[model samples]
Target: MIRRQREIDTPHISWPDKLAYSLPALSLAIIGIPVYVFLPKFYTDTIGLSMSTIGILLMAVRLFDAVTDPVIGYLSDRSAGRFGRRKPYIASGSVGLAISIIFLFKPPVLSGAMINIYFGFWLFALFFFWTLVAIPYESLGPEMTGDYHERTALFSMRDGFLIIGTLLAAGFPMLIDGIMNIMGKVATQRELFSFMAFIFAPLIVIFSFYCIYRIKEKYQQTGSDDLVKGFSAVLKNRPFLILISGYTISAVGSNLPATLILYYVEYVLKAQRAEGFLLIYFLTGIVFLPLWIVVSRKVGKKRAWIISMLINTGAFSGVFFLGPGDAMIYGVLVFFSGIGFGAGLALPSSIQADVIDYDQVLTGQRREGRYIGLWSIAKKLSAALGVGIGLVLLAKAGYQPNAEQPGSAVFMLRVLYALVPCICNILSIVIISFYPISEQAHAQIQREIGRL
Candidate 1:
C-alpha cells in the first residue's frame, strides 16, 4: 500500500482565500467564451467577411496562438519576481486583453481594403493577449492547493463562478439587444460594441486585479540555473501528454456545437429569435452546474466526465433525427445536453489538478504554468478547428447567411451541428475512459510527494 501524505502538517487555507484567488482566473473564461462563440459570428455577419475567409483567418491566427503557449508556459515556469512570475504575466496579460478586446470590437472608421487590415490587426492582438491571461491564470488552480479533495472543491468554486461568466458571455449580447429594443432605442453594431465595453470591460479589469491581490501562492520559487532541464522535465511527463491530448479532442467536441448553435437555430430551425433559445440552453447548463460538481465529487472525476460525454453525445445525436419545425423538441435536447456540458465544465480542471500532483511526485518541481499553458493551447487549437470545420461545412453546403439557405445547405447544417459533435463526443468518452488518475490515486500521489 502507498503511504498517504500526513494531513496534519499541511497548512489550512480558508475558503474565502481560495475564492478570491480563483475568481480572477474565472473572469478569463467570461472573456474567453464570448471571444470563441461570438467573434466568428460578429466577423462573418457584422464585419461582412466571407465565412471561408473568416474561418481561414481564425484557423491561421489560432494555430499561431496555439504554438506560442508552450514557450510562454516554459518561460513562466522559470520566472521569479516580487509579484511572482504568474502574477506579473497575469497583470500584463489582463491589460493586453482589455486593449485587444476594445480593438477587436471597435475597428477603425475606414472600410473596404483598410477594414481587412484593421480586422487582421484585431485578430492578431486578441489571440496574443488572450494567451498571456489564460495560460498563467489556469496554472494558478493546481498550485493553490495540494489536497486532492480540496483541489476538487477549489475547482468547483472556480467552475461555478466560471458558469456565471459563461452565462454572462453567452447571455449578455441578447440581454443588451433586448434591453435596447424595449426602450425603443435602436443601437447600431458599433454602439453595441461600445456599450459592452463600457459595461463589462471595467468589471474584467477590476475583478482580475482584485483576484491577483487576494490569492497568495504557497510555492516559493527556487533559483536554479537548470531552467532548460526544468522544461525538459515537464515535457517528459507522459501523463500530462495523455491528458492534454484527450482534453484537446474533447474540447473540440464541446466547442463545435457552441460555435454553430446560433447558425443552426437561425438557418435550420428558421427561428430568428435564436437568442431566447440559446438563453434556455445556457440556463439549463447554469442550473445544473452545482449538481455536476457534486456528482463529480461522489463518483470521481474521470467517471463523472465520461458520464457527461455520453449524455452530450446522445443529445447531439438526437438532432440528426429531428426535422424542421421541431424547434421545441430540439430545445429539450439542448437542455439535457447542457447538463452534460455542466459536468464537462466542472470536472476536467479537478482532474487537471490531479495530473499536476502526479507530475510533482515524479519531477520534484511544480511546473503548473507550463502544464496549463500547454492545456490552454490544446483547447484553443480545438476551438480553432471547430470554427474551421463549421466554416468548411457551411461552404460545402452552400450556406448563405443573409439569403435563403438551400435544402442541401439546411440538411448539411443539421448533420454538422448534430452528427459531427455526437461522433466527436463518443470518441471523447473513449479518450476520457483512458484517463488513469482517480480521486484515491491522486490523494495517494499527494501523500507520496509529502513524504519526499
Candidate 2:
C-alpha cells in the first residue's frame, strides 16, 4: 500500500508557477465578456442586424458549441504527440481564436443577412478554437497537484485572475469611451470592439505561448483505451454528476443577476448610471477570494460553497424590496453579495478537480478533459436557459426596451433579477447537499487507485 501510494505522488507547484499557469485565464475572461455581454448589442446596433436574427444566430451557434465539447474532450484525452496532449491544442487554438476575433469584429460592409452569415461562420470558428484552448487548459489543474487543498488554492488563483481579466476587459472600453466623452468626441461601438480585439489578440498569443512553454503537463502513461466504455463510465461517476448539476444550477443563478443588472439599475433603482456600483461588485469578488479560500480550508469545500450560496441568497433577497433612488442601498447590497460571488467563482472548479481525482481512481485512467468538457456544456446550457427564462418572463410582463414600462413589467423584472436567482441558489444548495465525496472518501479513493 505504501509503495503504491508513493508511485502516484506529484510535486508541489509553487505560487509563481500557478500564477504563470493561470495567465491564460486572464485572456479567456477578456475574450469571453465581449462575446457574451457585448457582441449581440454590437451586432444589432452597430452592424444593422435585427435583434431576432442576432438572437437566433447566437442560440444556434452556442448550442452547436455545447454539442461539440465532449467530442473535443474525447479527442483531447486520446491525443499524444511531441507537443504533449494539452499544449498543441492550446497553441494552435490561440492562433485560431485571434484570427476569428479580428475578422468577426472588423467585418466589411454587408447587409443585415450577410452580416448574420458572417457572424455565424466566425462565431462557430471562435467557439471551436475556444473549446480547443479551454477544455485541455482546465484539465491541467488537477494534474498539477495531488494535495486537495492545494487544488483549491490553485483554482483560487485561477478564479482571481479571471476576475481581474473581466475587470480589465470591462473597464478598458468603458474607460476609452469615458475619455472620448470628456474630450467631446464620439467613438462608435465598432471602433471600440475593433480596438479591444486588436489589443487582446496579441495578449492572447503571448499568454497562450507562455502557458504552453512554462506550465508543464504532468506525464501520465495510462489513459482510457476504449472511447465508448470510457465516456459511459464518466457519465456514471456519481460525484461528477452531482457536481455538474449543482454547478449548472448555480450558474443560472449567477448569470441572471448579470443579465439583468443594467435593467435593475435603470428601472428599479431609477439610476442614470450604476457602473461604479457594478465595478464594486466584481472587484469584491477578487478581493474576497483569499478569505473564501481560508474558509474552505476550515470547513471543507462543499460546506464553504454552501455558505457562499446562502450569503448570496440572503443578500439578493433584499434587492426585491428596493425602490427608486435606492442606489446607495443597492451598492451596499452588491458589496456584501460579492463575497459569495468570489467563493462561487473559486470553489466549484477546485471541487471539480477533486472529483476528477476520484474518477482517475475509479477508471484507472486520466480523463480530465472529458469531464471538464461536460462541465463546460452544463455552464453554457445554464446561461442559455437563464437568459431565455428571464426574457420570456419579461416579455410576458410587457417589458419593452428603452421605453417606460408599466408597473407590472417593472415588478416582473425585479422578481426575475432578484427572486429567481435566490430560488436557483436554494435549489443548488439542496442538490449539493447530497454530494458524497468528503475528504476521507477522497483519500480512500486515492489509496484504492494506488493499489490498482
Candidate 3:
C-alpha cells in the first residue's frame, strides 16, 4: 500500500512560483465578471424576459448547480491523470465556458416555441460550463500554497485582477459606444454583447490555456478511493463546514447592495444615466482594493475583514436617511462602502484556503476540490437567494420594469437598499468573528504539518 507522503518543511514559494500559479485564478476572475454582473440584465432587458421569470429560471438552474459542484469536486479530488488531476478539467472547462459564453450572447432569430428552447438550452449550457470552470479553478488556491499569509497575497493578486475584469465588463459598453461613434456606427446593447463576446471568448480560451500551461500541481494520487467516503470525510471537517456556513450568509449581504443599485439610481435618484453611477460604485471599490490587502497583512485577515464589514455597514446605513435629492451624499456613501466591499471580495478565499490547510493536517489528504466545490455551492446558493429576495421585494413594492415608478415603490427601494444589507452585513461581521483561524494559528498549523 502506498501511504500519502508526510509534509516536509518546504521553503516558502519563490516569487516566480507565486506568479505562475496565480495565472489560472486571474483568468477565472476575468471571465467570472460577465456571468455575475451582466447575465441577469441580459436576460431581463436584452432578451425581453420578465424579471420574475428570469429569477425563477436562474433559481431552477442553480438548483442543478447545487448538485453538480460537489460531485465535480469529488471527482477532481480522486482523479489520477498523467497531466495532473486539475489540469484536464481546467482546460476542458475553459473551452466549454468560451463556447457557452458565445452561445449565451449570440442568440439566433427564433420565435414562438423556439424562443423558449433557446432560453432553456442557453441557461443550461451557461450554468453547466460555469460549474466546470469555477470549481476546479477555485481548488487551485488551496493547492498552490499552504501558508496563510501567502494565500492572502495570492488571493489579493487574483481578486485585484478580478476587479480589472469587472471594471472592463462594466465599462466596456460605454467604451465600445465611444469607439463606434468615432467609426460612424451606432452601438446597441446587442452590438455591445456581440463585440464583447467576440473579444472575450478568445481571451478566455487563451488565458485559461496559458494558466493551465504555467501552473504545476504538487499533489498526485495513484490509488482510487470510494467517492462516498471521500465526500463524507470532507463533510466531517468542522472548520470547512463553519467557514462555508458563514460565507453563504455573508454572500447574501455582499450581493444585496449591488442588486439594488440600479433601482436606487434610476427610481430614487432619478438618474437617466444610471450605469455611470454604477460604474462609479464599482470603480470606488477597485481603487480601495489594494489598501485592504495592505491592512490585511498588517492587522491579520480576520480582523481586517471585520473592520471592512463595519465600514460597509456604516456606508450602507447612510442610504436609509437619504431624501430624493441626495445623489451626492449617496455617491460619497458608495465610495465608503467600496472600502468594505474590497475587503469582503478579497479576503474570504484566503480564509477558506486556511481552513483547507487545517483539514489536510487532520486527514493527511489534500481535499482542495471538495472544499472549493462547497465554497462554489455556497456562493451560488447565496446569489440565488439574494436574487430571489430582490424579486420578492420588487414584487411586494409593485416595481414594474421600465414603467414610471410611484413614490411608495421608490420609498421601499431605498429602505431595502439600505436596511436589509446593513442588517445582513452586521450579522456577517458577527459570524466571521466566530471563525477561529487566525493568521498566527494557520502559520503554526503549517509548521506542525511540516513536522508530521
lDDT of each: 0.73, 0.83, 0.74
Top TM-score: which candidate number? 2
Q: What tens digits encode model 1's per-residue C-alpha lDDT throughout 262-334?
A: 7888787777677676677667776787777677778887887888888888888888887668899888888
Query: Arrange candidates by lDDT, highest first: which order?
Result: 2, 3, 1
Distance from true location, Cα of 339 in model 1, Å: 1.0
Q: Against the hidden true structure, what lDDT does model 3 obtain?
A: 0.74
Tens-place lDDT digits, model 3, residues 255-284: 776787778787887666666666666677
- Candidate 1's displacement at residue 371, Å, is 0.9
Worst lDDT 10-window in candidate 2: 1-10
Badly placed stretches (over 4 Å) of model 1 are 1-13, 33-57, 111-119, 174-184, 222-232, 266-272, 397-411
lDDT of 1: 0.73
Each model's backbone clash number? 1, 0, 0
Instruction: Determine which window of 10 residues in candidate 3 has minimal summed lDDT.
Output: 1-10
Enumerate residue pairs that collide in model 2: none
Which residues of candidate 2, in runs, are more than 4 Å off? Answer: 1-8, 112-114, 178-186, 224-227
Model 3 Cα shift for residue 203 (angstroms) = 1.0
Please give each candidate's TM-score: 0.86, 0.94, 0.89
Candidates 1 and 2, the one with greater TM-score: 2
Q: lDDT per residue, candidate 2, 1-452, as tens digits? A: 11111234464678778987889999999998888888888887788888888777777878787777877777777777666777888899899999999998887899856777888899899888889888888887777877767778889898899988988888888788998899999888878988988998878789989988877776433464676777789889998889888899889988888887888889888996667877888888888999988998898999999999999888899999999988888899999899888789778998888888788777767788888888888888888888888888888999988998899989998898999899999999999999998877777876776577
Alpha carbon RMSD to native, model 1: 4.1
